[model samples]
Target: MPLSNNKSPAATDIYTISRLNREVRTVLEEVFPTVWVRGEISNLAKPASGHLYFSLKDSSAQVRCAMFKNRQSSLRFEPENGMQIVARANVGLYEGRGEYQLIIQSLEPAGAGALQLAFEALKQKLAAEGLFDEDHKKLFPLFPKNIGIITSATGAAVRDILSILKRRYPAANVIIYPTLVQGEGAGIEIANAIKRAERRKECDVFILARGGGSIEDLWAFNEEVVARTIFDITTPLVSGVGHEIDFTIADFVADQRAATPSAAAELISPDSAEVLIKLKHREEQLIRTQKQTLHNYQSRVELLSKRVPHPQQRLIELIQRTDEYSMRLKHQVEKQISNKKMAMTEIAGKINELNPAHKITQQIEKVNVLEIQFKKSITRSLEKAQDEVSSLSQLLNTVSPISTLERGYAIVTEPKTNKIVTNTKHLKSGDQLRIRLASSEIDSTVDSIHEK
Candidate 1:
C-alpha cells in the first residue's frame, strides 16, 4: 500500500517516517554527544561483519548498543554477556527501524582496566629493547640439576610447581626463593631474588611464577624492574606469571614462557619414564654392536686357521692372540651389561620414590616389564656369546696336529737330539729311538729299517 503524506489544512508541516527518524537522531546526537553508560551486558551478538550488537541494561531499562569494528578496536577487554562494562557512546536513532540506540566509541571493564593499558605500555618498551628477541631467549635445559622457583612462599603457585617438578623429575634439587608475588614492592623483591640466584649460580634454571589473578593483582610481573632483571639473567628463566590467558611484561622478557606454574616445572625437567626408555634403547644398541664384533672376530679366526700357512710357533701365537681377543670381548660385554643394569636400577629407584599413590601400581608394572625384557636380552646375548666361543674352541682343536695323535698315529724321534726322524737316512741300526703315541712315549731300538 502506498501511504500518502496527508496533512490537515492547518498542519502544513507533515513528516514521513524517514524525516522523523532523521530528526530524532540529530536531536539525540546533539543531546548526548558523549555519554558514559555503565551496565551489565546482555544479548551480545558479534557477527562476521566484525560489529558488536549488544544490549546494555540495568534492572529496569535497556538500550541497544552497536560497536563497529573500528570502535571495537579500542576495547581493552572483550565484551561478553553478563560482563559489567562502562561504554563511551553517542546516542542516536536508527533510521531503518526508527529505534533509539547508543553507538559505542570505546569500552572497558567498569573501573578496572587501567592496569591493562600499563601492561601494554611496558610490554612494548621491553620488546623494543630486544628483551623479547628470539636470540635472547634460551632454551630450557632438558635436565636441570637445580630448579629455582621465585614466587610467593605460601601461595598455590609454589606448591603447584613443586608438585609437578617432584612428579616429573624427582632427582632435581628444588630451591625456593620465596618472595611476595603481588602488592607493593613485590617487583623489587622478585628482581632481587633473580639477582641473588644469578650471583650464587646455584640453580641451572629459574621459574618466575604466580597464580592467576586480576590484572592489578598480577601487575608486579608487569613492572619494568622485573622485565629488566629477567632479560639480564644468564640462567634461563621461565615466566609463568598467571593463567594461560594472562601474560605480563616479565613473560615477554623471560627466556621461556609457560602458561602456568606447573607448566614451567615441566619445561625445565626431563620425564623419568622417557629417560628410562631411551636408556633401554641405548643398551640394546650396545649389545648388538658387541655381538657383531664378536662374530667378526670368530669368522676371522676360523678363516686364518683353515687357510693361512705358518710355522707351528707362529700359528700358536696367532691362536693365543685370538684367545686374548675373545677374552677381552667377553669382559667388555660383561662390563657394559653391568653398567646398563646399574643405571637402570638407579633411574627406576628414583621413579619409584616419587610415584604418586594413584600411579604407583602402574609404574611398578611397567618397571617389571622393562626388567624382564632386560634380563631376557642379557640372557640371549650371553648364550649367543658362549655358543660362539664353543664353536671357536672346536675349530681350534680340529686344526691342531695334536688332534691327529688321537687317530692311531706315532712320531719317531732321536732320543738324544729330540729331533723327528722323518726319513730312514737320518737313523741307523742300534740307534736309540723314541716313539711318541697319542697318550704316551715309548723307547725302541731300531734293529731293522723299513724304507716305506
Candidate 2:
C-alpha cells in the first residue's frame, strides 16, 4: 500500500515554531477552558517574583505548571515538593519553549478544604504573634454611646444587632459600615471597613459580626488582614461571626467574642429596665436620707427654740441687770474714792517723812558732829602712833640684819645663785662668794670649804 515518493503533492499549510506554538496554545486554551487537576507536586520553585513553577505528577505521568503571584497569593497553604495538591488551571503552551503547561488560577491542599486550612493557618499565625492573646484584648464597653457595626447592612446579623440594641438600650446610636462577609475579596473589604471606621472615630465600640454560616461563608473574618485590623484599632470590638459552636479568627482576635450577633448586642448595650430599677432604688435611698436629714434639722430647731429666750423678755432681763450693775458700780466708785482719799493722806504723811529736805537737815547736823569727833580722835591717834613708832624703830634696829652687819657680823651668799651660805657642804672650791655688808656687797672666790 506504499505510495510512490514522486507523486504530485497537493498544496498544504505550513507554520514556524512560534506560529505553531501559538496555535497550539490557542487550541489547548479553547479545548480545556478551566480544569481541576489532582497530583503530587514536585520540583517546586518560588522565585522572587512570587510566581510558582512546579511539576504536578502521578505515578504514571506529570505536567508542568505555573501559578502567578495574583493567584498564588490566594493559596491557603504553602505548596511543597511531594505535597498532594489540586490545581484549577487553564491548559496552554509556552511559545518560547513550545511546551505544554497548566496556568493555575487557584490551588488547594488535596485532602482538606482550602478555606478551613486557611483559617487554621491564619489562626496559628496570629496566635503565635500574640494577636489572640488575652492581654491584647480590650474590655467591652458597659454603656457604649455609639456602636459601629462592620457587617453586611442587609444581612440578618444587622437586624438582630439593631433589634437587640433597641430593646436593651434605646439611647445607644448605631453606625453601620456595610461590608462583605463572604466570597472573594471579602476579607480585604472587611479589613478596609474596620480601618475606615477607625479613621472616622464614630463608635465607642465595634461589633464585627455576621449571622451563622459555613466556614466559606464566614471566611472573611478569619482572614489575617481582618484579624490584624481588629487588633490594631483602638476601639473595643466584639466579634460575633457565627453560632455558639463556631469560632472564627476574628473571635479570637477581637476584644470580646460573642456566641451570636444578638449576644454581641447584649454585651455592648446596657439593660434599660435593670438600670431604671437601680436608679429607682437609689432615688428611694436618697429621698429617705433627705427626709432623715430634714427631721434631724427640725429636731435641732425645736430643741434650740426651747433653749432660746423670747426677744422682749431677754431685753427686759438685760435692762434690769444693767440697772442693778450701774447702781452697784456707782456705790463701789464712791467707796473707792473715800478709801483712796484716806490712803492718799497716809501716803502723803509717809512721803513727808521720806522728803530730801528733812533728811538733808538731819544729815548735816550728824555730819558736823562726826567731823568734830573725827578730828579729836585723829589728834589723839597721831600722838600715840608717834610714840609707838619710836619704840618700834628702836626694837627693829636691834633685830635688823643691817644692825648685825654694822656690829661686824659678815653674811655670805653664793654670787650667781644668790643663796645664803649656811652650810659649807654646799660650797665648793673655785665657787664665787658674795659678802653682804650693811651698805654694799663684796664678791670673792672660795679658797677652801670646811664642814662643821
Candidate 3:
C-alpha cells in the first residue's frame, strides 16, 4: 500500500508540489534526527571537490548520502562502491531535488563495527558463565623461574617486554613463543601457542603481549578463542595487549592485565637490585649480631680469668685467716676466765637480789611512781576534754537555727509539704503556712500578698 496525499479539496489551504515535498522532508527529518545505517555503497561519485556522494543500499532499499570532505578525510580505510559500512548520520532533505538523504557524520568498515558488537556479546557470554571470574584465575608465581612470552616475533611489543624483564630480573629464564598478534589467523595462532606452552609446562607464568594499535589491529586478543585458551591454562597468564585505555577479552580472562608489555614484565619479575639490597642488609645484621656475641664471650672469659685465683695465693689467704682465728681464740679464752670470775661475784649478788622482801620493796616503789603518772595523765585528759566540750557548745549555739530565730527572724514553711517558703510565687493570699519563731511554731494563712 502507498500513502496518499489526498487532502479534501474544500479544505482552506492547498499545497503546491514543492511545498508538499518540503513538508514531507521536514516530517522525515523530525522523525529521525540521527541514525545508524548499515549497507553497501552504490552509485559512488567524487566530483574532485573532496565531497563524497553515494547511495547506501541493501537488497530491498537504498538512500542517497553525502559525506563532506572533513568527515571523509578522517576515515581509516578508503570507501569503495561494493564495500559494506556502518554510518552515523543525520537525516536530511535536498530541497533542490526534493529527495530525502543522509548526511554522514562518520562511518567505519562493517567488519570493525561487527567486531565491536561481537566483542561485547562474547564478553557478556563469557562473564555470565564465570570464565572471567577471579576464582578461575591462577595466582602469579611469587618467584617465577621460567617466563613464557607470546607475542609477535618482530614487533616492538616483544622487544619492550624483553628489555624490561632484563632490567628488572636478570636471573629468570625467558621463553619466547612468537605468534601473529593480529590478522586473519592471529587468534588461532595465539591460542595454539598458549596450548603448546601449557603442554610443555616449563614456564611458571605466561605473558600475552602486543603493542598499541587500532581495535581492529589488536582484535586477536578480543577473540573468543584466545580468551578461552587463556582461561583454560593452569599457568598464570597476564594480558598486555595495548595501552592502558585499551582492554580486550583476554584481559578479563587472564590472571591479571598489565597496561603495557613493559608493565607485564615488571609485574611478574622481582627487582634484582632491590633484592640484592635486602640481602646486603641482612648480611650486615648478621655480622653485627656475631660481633656482639663474640664481644660478650670475650668479656666473660676475661672476668673468669680474674675470678680464678692462683693456687699459691689461695693457700696464703687460707693460712692468714687461720692465724687470725688462733689469735682470736686465745683472747677469747682469757676473756672467758675473767668473765667466769666476774660472773661468780655477779651471781652471788643476784642471789641476794632474789630475796623476796627486797624484790617486793622495789615493786612497790615502781607501783607508786606509776600511780602518780597515771593520776596526772587522767587529770590532764579530763581538763582537755572539758575545754573541748565548752568550745564546741559555744560554737553550736552561735550558729543554731534557734539562735537565728531569736534574733527577730522567723522561718516560714508551706504546710502542705513542710518546705521552706522563701518564694511567694507559689503562694496565694489564703494559702496556709507554718511560722516557726524562737520557741514556738504557729500555723497561719498567707496574708494579703506583698513583693519588694
**Each prediction's whole-model lDDT (CA):** 0.77, 0.72, 0.74
Worst window of 10 by summed lDDT in candidate 1: 354-363
Best-fitting candidate, scored by lDDT? 1
Candidate 2 TM-score over all chains jointly: 0.45
- For 111-218, candidate 1 gives per-residue lDDT tens digits of 554565567677787778788899988877666777899888899999999899767788778899988888899889989989998998998899989999887898
Backbone clash pairs in model 2 (N, Cα, C under 3 Å; residues 3+ apart or in different chains), count: 0
Write down the lDDT that model 3 would get: 0.74
lDDT value, candidate 1, whole model: 0.77
What local lDDT score does residue 305 receive in model 3, on the 0 to 100 scale? 29
What's the lDDT for residue 316 in model 3?
41
The TM-score-based order of candidates, best leading, equals 1, 3, 2
Encode model 3's per-residue lDDT on 1-452: one tens digit a residue.
23369634554366777888888888988999899889999999998899999999999999999999988765877899999998889998898898889999888899787776688899999999999887887888666778999998899999999999777766678899989899999999999999999999899899999999988999988888898888888899998989998899999999999999999999998775565455346434543543454345334322322333334444344334333433443344345334533543443344322332233345346434644554454345335434433444433322211123455878899887877787898888889999999789999987788888
**If scored against the real structure, what TM-score would every candidate get?**
0.60, 0.45, 0.49
- Which one wins by TM-score: 1 or 2? 1
What are the clashing pairs of model 1?
A: none
lDDT tens digits, residue span 1-452, model 2: 34477775443544678888998899999999998888999999988998999999999999999999888666757788999887789999988998999999988877545565667787888888899888987777666667899999899999999999777776667899998889899999999999999999888899888998766677777778888888899999998889997899889988888999999988887776665455346434543543454345334322322332334444344334433433443344345334534543443344322332243344346534544554354345334433433444433322211123454768899867766787778777899889988678899998987665
Q: Which is the winner by TM-score between candidate 1 and candidate 3? A: 1
TM-score of 1: 0.60
Error of 2 at 21 (Å): 56
Each candidate: RMSD:
18.3, 41.8, 35.6
Q: Using alpha carbons, what is the TM-score of model 3?
A: 0.49
